[model samples]
Target: MELLPTTIVAGPSLLTRASALDQVVGKLRAGKVYRREDLAYVSNAVDRHLREMVSGGALKRLAQGLYYAPKKSVYGTLPPDDQELLATFLRDKDFLVFSLSSYNTLGLGTSQLYNKTLVYNHKRHGIFSFGNRQFDCRVKPRFPKTLTPEFLLVDMVNNLDELAEDRNLVLQMVVRKLPGFDQAKLKRAVSNYGSAATRKSFARWQDG
Candidate 1:
């Protein structure tokens, strides 16, 4: 049997790993979602540390390989923030996180606010749960890193059918507001982000 070098598996290296893990754990902001790999660089025994952390109630596993060091309040342990959770799940901060209810604010006659949220990400697609809330994750060809009014206007028209609103009234309002939008940006959104059906519906307005 070959004996490994003493320096290769020294106590100092183990201590350093432990120290790094402890530092990262101590600094983990409450209500922030994290992946196991997010802290793997901190320690070689990261999985062990994570299991222990979960057992000790120091962290909550939100999903497969997803976790958060919770925030306690008078009501209960507060869930991770929506944007923070989405960023961890999608592994990209460049994605857009928005409540579908935001479309209501476009003044397209959508008065009923939706409880749903959506994620426009290049990495993931589907519905995912975080605590009690669910995010409808979608993959898109071209989505702006941030939300824009022009994008919202286009998106509102694009997703018009899916919304729980009066379609005819909303369409009337959309038509009325169409000319007020930033022409260049709206055109790009319709061509890029809008679905085929949406683009077809929007084409009539563009032609007028």
Candidate 2:
């Protein structure tokens, strides 16, 4: 029998690309979502590399500038959480905070998990979604200086039980963080609370 000549195909180039894709996938698997700018910062080839990975099924686009690895079948067809996605989108833009997120952080409100309810300085109109999560972006005119700082403190108080389950400790922490805060704005927020007793209690805390 006559021997046939075998052709050698290039493999190292493919391997190198696969290795880079693996690195990117590893980052995503570790819960790191890269923004386009971050990716650009990491490498000039990041965009092309990311596109290749996306085409090869190694990376899934959660949204523009957001991605994830689909190695585990857990996420189904849905994208990443909207808040997570929005946070990435607004990472460069200041004045974006989850409304309920701040409330949860402040140890003030009830324990209720909400979708991404972000408040930004722009006019309240931009709303979008990513995967199973919804981004309800609200624009606040006038860019009130008290909004972000005050709401963040209130959110800490709202999630006090989750923080330690010791109400006294939580209240103490809240009180401690209150000084140097905008007292008038804080009072207004307390007054806006639905319950008169709750408002009075918070007012006492504010005064104290």
Whole-model alpha-carbon lDDT for candidate 2: 0.58
**Runs off by more than 4 Å, candidate 1:** 1-27, 43-45, 72-76
List the lowest-lDDT window of 10 residues for candidate 2: 155-164
Number of the top TM-score candidate: 1
Error of 1 at 182 (Å): 2.4
Alpha-carbon RMSD of each model: 8.0, 9.6
TM-score of 2: 0.47
Clashes of 2: 20
